[model samples]
Target: MKRILVIAIPLLLLTGCMHLNDPRPKHYKAPVTTVANKVCVIVQPEADEQIVTIRINEIGNDNNTLEKYGLAVIASAERCVTDFGYAFTAGKAYNFMVILESPEKKKRGVQPSARIYGASFSLWRLNGKLQATPLY
Candidate 1:
């Protein structure tokens, strides 16, 4: 009985460790492409400004050629915000597509993992308008 108990305990410990190493599911989609040219917009606040870092992941399965589609800096905004002004070029329309990625929880030491939760993207316009084509 004593020998059997020892072997069972080790087996249980090994099984527990094996389950801990299981890979997490990849739940993210790539960003969509836009016909309009992309321009980086940096909005500075007047006073007590807050800066944000926005990431625009490429939209496609080609991992080797991932490019940043749209990037902008907004002040005091909770989520990512983009606006297109006259600088986008008069008469020529533009579109903006984004893939918002949710922050993932990473494992740290023996404690449970921590995750910030992120989102991914779609398409919009550089002029703050949603259109199918840049020419429109």
Candidate 2:
């Protein structure tokens, strides 16, 4: 029993050490360009009264090349409050996420341009007014 216990402990320690050398990239890259004109917002009905979720979609062109970059919380909250009207309680916060679609690239004569489109956003709410904060 003592021999097995010694062997198992060292193996466990080695396994734990192996996890410290993870190879995945730790940083996030920002998008190169954003297509503002093509955008849409969808609200999801929630069973919970305290929390609400809204999904914002930034769509690409006719080619259907779309990529979800991230969410813009403040912009979405403002649009929702303006268009949908605010009936929720003041100080009640909502969660928002942005869905990004890849835009079709156009070649402007000899130069080929690639546009990186994505989304990002933060928490928001309406407390006598609409507010948004960009998430990091």
Candidate 3:
């Protein structure tokens, strides 16, 4: 439809113009802090040269809507493990998401690629270690 194309074309063009040097997060919604306790989260890219974003959500019980708990941007490949400093309540469910982006190709002066990849996982803490079971 015309309405769909009007919005989609400009979005595609804008993303296609994104450069590889723009590795920082444009905005963040959650106020998250970190601690060096007996907790850790590991996220690795399936391919090299990608931007990574992490989102933590709480699975609903009485309130069935998942609430966003934390958001983080991991730019470039340095370290993959981070402690979100959130205390995981026993017997509760949480969702962990890793979003990867490569708005442009690895080389300069080439047409922008504008690709996004992601993986979602169910989180659990067993025996003082964190476990992430992939959902997708």
**TM-score against truth, every candidate:** 0.24, 0.28, 0.37
C-alpha positional error of residue 80 in candidate 2 after TM-score superposition, expressed in Å: 24
Report the number of the highest-lDDT candidate.
3
lDDT of 1: 0.35
Better of 1 and 3 by TM-score: 3
lDDT of 2 by residue, 32-115 (tens): 111232122332211211112233322222232222233322332223211233232222232223322112212222112121
Q: Give the alpha carbon lDDT tens digit for every residue of 8-118 in model 3.
A: 999999998887666553321221112332323343443433444444455674343222333334444345434354445544555544444443443553333223333
- Shift in Å, residue 82, candidate 1: 12
lDDT of 1 at 51: 27
Give the candidates in order of TM-score, highest first: 3, 2, 1
Question: Cα miss at 7, model 3 (Å)?
Answer: 32
Model 3 segments more than 4 A misplaced = 1-39, 46-52, 61-72, 75-83, 106-136
Clash totals for all candidate models: 15, 15, 0
| Cα error of candidate 1 at position 94, Å | 17
